[model samples]
Target: MSPVFAHGQLRLYLLSLLNEGPRHGYEIMRDLEQRFNGLYTPSAGTVYPRLAKLEEEGLVSRGDDGRKVTYTITDAGRAEVARRQADLGDLEDDLDRSASQLADEVRSRVKGEAADLRAELKAAAQEARRVAQPATGEPMSGRARGEFEQAINELRQSARSILRSRKTAESVRAEALRIVHEAKRQLDQLK
Candidate 1:
């Protein structure tokens, strides 16, 4: 299945995470972090709401043993988890063939790519922090702050493309790639 990374997706993740056994929210996050190799350790805000949603859907039932709210997958949730597991297997096999090797090939590719991404994000955050300093640019006044918020909103909108289905994701990826290419061209022009 196309694993959604949104807050709503936490239902699927929580169900899937608890397929082996019951777990609380933090336990679910820890399991996901382990499974995803620390690429995503979902925050409480993302996890809890999704768990609540799952409960409402009857996919995840909560049992307060004593302290923490323990969640176990229902029969419907188990079937959903089974379907998703098969989907995940298909996705994995496709990824394996796409890279023309085992999953390790992709993992090997990530080392450099992740490092570069970390550095770039770090630089961007540093730049943003520097630019947002109270001493500079009048602290982003009314219209400017609105514009910044608008930009952020658009980014979140685009990021939501990942939540789309496989067919839709293909189209979204094309658009995203086009945008990335344009950004690269602009950066080259700046250089």
Candidate 2:
């Protein structure tokens, strides 16, 4: 949860969003996630209750359209939005700040995780090379070393590409961790 949506601000913001157009609950949740850059995704539990509350307060009205219920801002909702124009502006500013901060935090965490993964991979490669050495204590053959290095480089590049892709940071992080873990597992098998 974000402080931007604290203290009944989410209700007001939801009203602001409905002011733009009518939407179902899922669309409202998706819109909020997009607006926050995927940093905050409100579950149905969080959103539906607030919507129900707003409906109870006569700030919004819902129309059943078969399987979906579309919510629209009532005249009272528009009035509330009009009355709290300044607060809405402040909330927007807070949202921008919070999104930026969350993005930075996610980047920092991913960077740290990537660094740790690199260190572990490097150590595992060195250990594998050591363990696979001949009785003469000779290093791995040049061809074998080249192939190993290339594989490691490719893995690193794949992780970097995932991080830089258009996917959300959370998804990127998960994919990167998956790659790292799989690589580690494969490396451990060589032991």
Candidate 3:
């Protein structure tokens, strides 16, 4: 997952959130998720530990009601927030950019998958046509059928390898090799 905050930025952001008003831990988490446009949601393990640390540092105080513990910024926490106002602004900008980038990546991936589906549909249509009307009105010879199945198997293997590598340079190289091999096979078939 993309990081929503830099190393020390979450602590500062939490302080700023509390500076706005007292909030329960779940409220803080939901507020953060909203702020990031649902791109990020902090787990309880992540937020509660940091809150505990802030309490230890005397920057925040927690009040336990029967069911929920609400946290409020201490005077020191407000002062810290005020002092780092500029830093907080920068953090907000970074978070906005990160969310936009993540959204863009998701969109691009969906487009790619759609394109792949279209190509597969086209290939299946072509294969159906070939099967329905053979060149000599006869089924493919055993050797020709074997070659066709081998080619399909190779294509599946290449696709699996590429997906496993996730578009890395090594996967790109493997794709190139697969293309070269297929080209050579086609040339041999022509002869």
lDDT of 3 by residue, 18-119 (tens): 999999999999998898676567899999999999999999999999999999999999999989999999998988888887667656754565455345
TM-score-wise, the better of 2 and 3 is 2
For model 3, where is the 10-residue window of minimal lDDT?
A: 124-133
Give each model a TM-score. 0.43, 0.71, 0.60
Q: List the residue pairs that clash in candidate 2.
A: none
Task: Please give the lDDT score at residue 91 for candidate 1.
Answer: 53
Deviation of model 3 at 147, angstroms? 20
Between prediction 1 and prediction 3, the one with superior lDDT is 3
Assess candidate 3 and give its TM-score to the true structure.
0.60
The residue-by-residue lDDT of candidate 2 on 83-183, one tens digit each, is 99999999888788888887877777667766765665565556455545466767788877776677567667766776766643664567567757766
Comparing 1 with 2 on lDDT, the higher-scoring candidate is 2
Q: Model 2 lDDT vs. the true structure?
A: 0.79
User: lDDT, candidate 1, residue 120?
Assistant: 45
Query: Highest lDDT among the candidates is held by which one?
Result: 2
Q: Rank the candidates by TM-score, best first.
A: 2, 3, 1
Q: RMSD of each candidate?
A: 14.1, 7.6, 9.3
